[model samples]
Target: MSFYNMVQSEKPATLLEIWEAISTAFTHNQNEQFQITDPRHGDFTVHIEQYADFSVMNNIYQPRQETLHIPIRPQVPSLLMSFCLSGKPGLSGDRWEASYEANQALFNVFPARNSTYVLPANTQHEDLVIKLEMHTPFLEEFTSDSDDQLSNLLYKATIHEESLHSLQGNLTIDQTASEILAGIQKCPYTGKLREVYMESQVKLLLVHQLSVVHRLQHSNKPDTTAKLTKADQEKLQELKLYLESHFLEDHSLQSLTKQFGLNLFKLKYGFKTLFNTSVMKFIDDKKLQYAHLLLQQENVTVFQVADTLHYGHYNNFSAAYKRKFGYSPQLLRKG
Candidate 1:
C-alpha cells in the first residue's frame, strides 16, 4: 500500500494483532522494551499505545538509553499528532522539542521512517498517538503555507527556542481539554464524518496550542509600518484595558475616537488587528470577566452588575455571560 489507511477490524483485535499492526505501521526498528496494547472503548478496540526506543526499521537502529522514541512514520507517508498523556524527556537532541503535558498536542508530518534515531535519556515518553495515511491533496488544503515539501510542523529544528518552550507548555491539556477529549472520543473514522471530525479536532487543537504559544512569545509585539506597528499594538492593549475599566461608560466609536485621537477607520481596524477582537466585542468580554468576578461577591446582584456594566437589559448580560461561561451567572453565583 502507498499509505497506511484506517483499520476497521471485522472483529475485536487482540494484543498480538495490535502489536504487529503498530510495528508494521510506525517503527522501522526498536529495542525490546517497546510495548503496545489494546485501548478498549465502547464496542471498539483502538490501537491506543505507548512504546520505548521506537525508530524506523528501514536502516540502522539506535536504542534510547532511557527515554522512549515514538517513530510516527508508517510504511507510508503520513501526518502524526500526539498528546503526552504523561512523561517527558529532560533533554532532546533535536533542536526542536515539543514538551507539553496532558493539555498539549503535537503535530508533525512524516515523510518516511528511518532505521536510526535517538532520544534524550532523562525524558520519559508517554503519549496518545493519532496517525493519518498520506494524503497529499488533503494536506495541501489544511496547511496554511503552500509547499510541495515534507516538513515536521510539530518540531521545527530551526524555530526560535523561546517559541518552542512556549509551544511545549501550551500543548498540554488546559481549559480546552474537555472539547479536545470529546472530539476525539466522538471521531468514528469512517465515511462522511471521518475526515470532517478528524480535520475539525486536529485544526482546533493545533490552532489553540499555537495561539497560546504565539501570545506568550509575542505578547507585546509591535505592528509593522507596512501593516500595524508595535505602537499600534500597544495602543490597542491600552484601549482594551480602558474598555475593561470603563465598560459601563458610553463607549461609542465617536466618543472613543474623540478622546483617544483615533479615527473610526483606525479604531475599527486597529482593534481587530491588534487584539483579534472588535471594540464592542472586547467590551463585552470585559463585562463578562467582571460578572464572573462579581459572582464571588456575597451581596452582589446579577442585575446590579449587569447595569453597572451598561448592559441595555439584564437578560442580554445573562445570556452573554451564559454563552461565554456555559452557565448562568446567577447559578454560578449561588454555587
Candidate 2:
C-alpha cells in the first residue's frame, strides 16, 4: 500500500488541520470536487464541506488502484458516522482493527492514537462521512448521562488515552437514509441555505441511525442471565450472518440447534442477548425489508415478492409487511 502520514498533532487536531494534510496531495476541481491522481496513491475524488461544529467528507475511490494508507495520530474528540455505500475501507492498530463493509452504517469516536486507515484497491469505494465535534452543542444532550450507552461510547475515548474506542452494530443503510444521502449529493440550494439544508439532513440521518440503534438495543429485552463464552458468541454471530444471507429459508429453532452445534436454550436466549431480537423475528424482519425493496421494482408484484421470499401465503406476507413498515406492499407499489 502507498503511505501518507497525516498532519501530526502537538495537541488535539481539528478538522481544518486534517483537511490541510489531505489538500497537500489533492488539487481543486470543478464544482468543489478535489482529485488525487498520484500514480503511487491510486485515483481518488474527494469533496469536503467544513462547518463550525460538523463536517462532511464525500469520497469516491476509483477502481484499478492500489491500497492507500493514511496513518492516524491523535485528534480532537469527535463522532464520525460513515455510510459505506461500496467497497471496504479499514482502520487498524497493533491489537484492534475495524473494516467498513458495503451497505453498513457505522459510527465511532475519536481522539485516536496510533491507528491507520487504508483505502481499498480493485473496487470503487463510495463513502459519506459526517463528523460531529464533541465540544459543540450538537452533542450536548448526550453528555448528560455518563452511564448511557452512547454517551459512554462517545465520551470515554476522549478521556482514555490508551484505549481505542469503537462501537458498531449491524445497522444497514435503509431506503430512508439512502434518500437523505441522495438529497445531499443533488442538493439544489446555494450558499447559507445549502449549508442549512445539509446540516438538517445530517441531523435527520443521525436521528434515523439512533432510532435503529435504539430499536436493536431495547426491542427484545436481552436475557441478562444468559452468559456466552467467546466461542458461543462467535457461533451466534456466525448464525446471524447465515440468517442474513439465507433469510428466505424456513428455519426451525431445532434445525438451527443441529446446524450450528448449539443448544436450544442458547439459540433461543443467547440470540436475543447478542442481537436484541429473536431468531425467527430477525429472519422475518429481513424478509419484510427485502419485500419492501422488491415492491419498488418496475414490474414486481407483492404476491411475487412474497412467493420469492418463500412466504407460505401472500396475504400473510402483506400483513407482516404492513406491521413492519406501516403500509402494505400494495400501497407501496401504488405510490
Largest TM-score belongs to which candidate? Answer: 2
Q: Lowest summed-lDDT stretch of 10 residues in model 1?
A: 53-62
Error of 1 at 49 (Å): 13
Over 4 Å off, model 1 = 1-21, 27-78, 89-101, 115-126, 132-135, 144-170, 187-191, 210-335
Query: For model 2, what is the alpha-carbon lDDT of residue 140?
Result: 65
Candidate 1: tens digits of C-alpha lDDT, residues 239-302: 7778867886777888887877777767887776545568988777877887798878988888
lDDT of 2 by residue, 127-226 (tens): 8878776667766655568877756543454445322213334355555777888998899998999989988998888766665655555667643423
The lDDT per prediction is 0.50, 0.67
Supply the TM-score for candidate 1.
Answer: 0.39
Q: Which candidate is the best by lDDT?
A: 2
Off by over 4 Å in 2: 1-33, 39-41, 63-65, 141-170, 221-335
Residue 302's lDDT within candidate 2 is: 74
- How high is the lDDT of residue 103 in model 1? 28
Q: Candidate 2: give the clashing pairs.
A: none
